[model samples]
Target: MRPYWCVAVAAGVLLVSACGAAGSGAAGSGGPVKLAFVYATSSQNPFQEMAFGAKAAAADIGGVDLALSAPTGINGPQEVTQFLSTIHNSKDGVALETLTPDLFVRPLNQAADLNVPVVAVDTAPPAGTKVGLFIGNSNTELGKALGEEFVKQVPADATGEVVLGNDIPGLGLLQQRLDGMRSVIKAKRPGLTISGPFDSGSEPTSNFNNWNDIVKAHANAIAYLGVGAQDAVSLALIQKNTGRKFLAGSCDPDTSALQAVKDGYVFALASPEHWLKGYVALRLLAERAKSGKALPTGWWNTGSLVVNSANIDQIIARQHDEGSRKAAFKAETDRQLANPSGYLRPLAEAN
Candidate 1:
């Protein structure tokens, strides 16, 4: 289990690690409720941080046996199979991230039949799915936040281009991010031509290779933006190495993204709060295990952060402290649940 905090976000791996203290108690006469976390993304820094949050929740909240798993790398078919295996393998409940919507429908329906409570983490269930809850963010709003930054930087009369690097078309969640970003950029700066939501091949090397061509073509684009974590880093490297000048921004964070922001190579970084996503997902599932009640389904936006040069260092430092991270996550979840007008909403089960 990779500790998301203290390692990946801090630019290197830690010498030692801390898994949350084991939980205690029993959900019923069947003994402790078995809980599993099945994520779609690889063991990337962001996902690791997410798992760290899940571990924290497992320790802090008693009476659940928690287990976490994901594919070895960025393999969707494996993830889909593992997702199916996880829910059906006698677990009491599950927190999952779907790689694709349709592929998991039958498994989710099976889960509902088996009385397995499921809460979606990182992405929302497709329409007509019986998943318990959705703990994520409004990608469109997140894009708007970035758009506001772009508006602040661009001159009203100056016409140029803004390029978006989005990878992995299979995941609709990322697509929403791209969609939101496109809307915001279009609405804010009509003169500034927004370019391709180009295929940023998932890994940094692939992203760099793909974006390298785009950079070669658009030598004078106004700004560069990415919907993936590595895309931000790749953009920073390309701009720095090739002397291609542009304001760089991105959708998520990793050590590379943080470094780029601190060095002023990246103007802003939108954090998806993966750690909080896992924590909240597991917490909601664990709660269901004990109470025998399904989650109030609907959207529970875990939230996002737009980090700039001024706050990059501070945010990275804050992310390293597991205790502080968990405390902040708890506070955020409490806030989302308490705020009636906020993104968090309730969905009654369809009768």
Candidate 2:
């Protein structure tokens, strides 16, 4: 995902002018609790699946009304507006996919004032902000996992160019993933000459065009690493057409990424358990709403894994099996509730 900035919250009186809070309402005595979820961007495949899990949880676990909302695109200001509007109307608890942490802290604190539980998903409260619960992955670890894959696939004494790509320059989100890849590569295979961690947009043409130019220039590049799903898929297509034998490492696995992995074009893709993310996050918020509990403090690493020829087929098959997926999710959710500390740990604990 392409992110804009990770703005830090100022240490002062929490401002309220920007985040709208004209009037707030709550459930009546012995009444159904109303809950909500807001995303920064529209329901892409991954996020759409997340909303599905949340709604399914609401159906199974009753006494709560689930309302989901989000802006069409990456409109940070509009997302804040929608979030405020959502919380204003539906009052109880909320799980939000925070685009800009700075824009959210004020309103989130406002929700806290109402005694409404707020859980952060996709992104989290910056350091020192007293947000009790955060649910997401250690993307840096995911990057490192992919780097390990690169070292395993590429020879130790290999000498060639490495073409890497990213969408935005200063996006705090992608930057972490990029940094993770760079750190791993530098540590494991310092002999490789990495080139063009270039600007790659989401559109297929842009990815293809940018990588096409880079691959043409550096025909000796041994492998290609991309920050997002599109980057690796585009390279996969290019490699197929050109019949080049470069190793490809991708960040996420969309259908194309999976197909590339199934074929020989892409070697490996690192992933944060996205399905687990949605189901577990919703379970956390729902537990907060039904019971008077809050999410645990510190980062909840969803865990990361590498997918290659050995596991891609099984993984792709599981993605289609909703029954099995939900069952696994339920088991994980039950385990988390039984012992959240066991399921998650501090960021410092991860490799």
Clashing pairs in 1: 4-49, 136-301
Clashes of each: 2, 0
Model 2 CA deviation exceeding 4 Å by range: 1-31, 127-129, 203-209, 321-324, 346-351
Considering every candidate listed, which one attains the maximal TM-score?
1
Scored by lDDT, model 2 comes in at: 0.68
Candidate 1 C-alpha error for residue 256, in Å: 1.0
Off by more than 4 A, model 1: 1-23, 337-343, 346-351
TM-score of each: 0.86, 0.82
List model 2 lDDT by residue over 233-272, tens digit each. Answer: 8888888888777888876657778888998788888876
Q: What 10-residue stretch in candidate 1 is worst by lDDT?
A: 9-18
lDDT of 1 by residue, 1-351 (tens): 332222222211111122333333335544556677777665566777777777776665655566677765676577777767767753667887755666777778878888778888776776667875777766776777777776777777668888877777656767777777788777767788888887877776788999888777777887878877788888899878977668888877688788888888888888887887888777777766766655765777777888887687778777767777776577776775466256666643210
